[model samples]
Target: MMEVKSKGQQVSRREEILDKAARLFKQKGYVATTMREIAEQVGMEAASMYNHIRGKEELLEEICARVAETYVNQMNEIESSDLSPIHKLQALIRSHISITTKNIHWISVANNEWRHLPDSSLKSFKKARDTYEDRLAEIIRSGIDCQEVADVHVSITLYTILSSLRWIETWYKPNKSYNARDLEENIVNILMNGLKKSG
Candidate 1:
């Protein structure tokens, strides 16, 4: 029992460190952030921090991998669901907003700082990112096939939607005027239905 508790505490401390490191990476960038600064953010001495993590690069890699895997897993689920193409797109958009809102710092770090990852990890992360985008493009292609979505350039459509979704980390704030659900619904409506009013 005591051993299990010790392990749990270690895990908790590691996560705490990751959380602070993610925020700092987003703000100052992965190249600019140091392990000592991360330790300071987490209220630990710089030397003692080595006991919890190998170094700063490990933190960035962990964050980028975690965020990328989450997106890939969610896309896999949406792809396998029984919903029609349009509905699947809606679900995907909603999930994107929800996850971005909940993990904005980590997502921001993943988006901006992933390039700093070591060679092998960088290759893997790029592959994961590309795969996720390809999955989204496939869904849009299916929608176009069924005449459910406009027959615009598939690559252009994917980029537009993804770029918009990715920017949420830059500007979104949890304030009284809007919330995650509201943002999700609005994005889905505009992306799915367009701005033209129907008679």
Candidate 2:
């Protein structure tokens, strides 16, 4: 028999493991972080780790999936909320950067350690990742459609934004100079308004 609680409680324990695993994977990477390391991070034993997940690959899948899923959900909801494509793009990019920064550890694994997963999980993860990028591209394309983004090279724009967000995990440190949220907003503004003088 399976036990169920409110969604929060039901998701809490697993979320704990995923969160800790994200931290470990980010710090040590997938090759270095053992299941036991994640288990210990979440206050569980090696054997007990199996109760929550099948194996490391599955854990990887969950970490990556949660990130992609969160981004997609945020984008979808915002798109449906009637925001202009330009505002939606800003909001989406801002949210994407915020979430990726908050989950830097998992984001690293999702980006760098992706090759370690078995075939099936890798495909699933790619699907989610592509969907996430496509969502952003859609917004950019919409902006072009409405003449907000101009006829710039849309693919390059999308790639630049995605790559910038992903690469920040390597250098981003919380400090007085800037935080992740501030950095995200700054990038958003720069992308919308180029460096060249408008006049």
Per TM-score, the best of the predicted structures is: 1
Error of 1 at 94 (Å): 1.1
Query: Candidate 2 lDDT, tens digit per residue, 33-134?
Result: 899888888888989878878887787877766666676677778889788888887777777777666666766777787888789878887887788777
Worst 10 residues of 1 by lDDT: 1-10
- Tell me the tens digit of each residue's lDDT in model 1 across 71-169: 887888889999988778878888888878888898899988888999999999999998998889998888878877777788988898888787799
RMSD of each: 4.9, 4.7
Model 2, runs deviating above 4 Å: 1-12, 195-199
Q: Please report how far candidate 2 places residue 175 from its true position, in Å.
A: 3.0
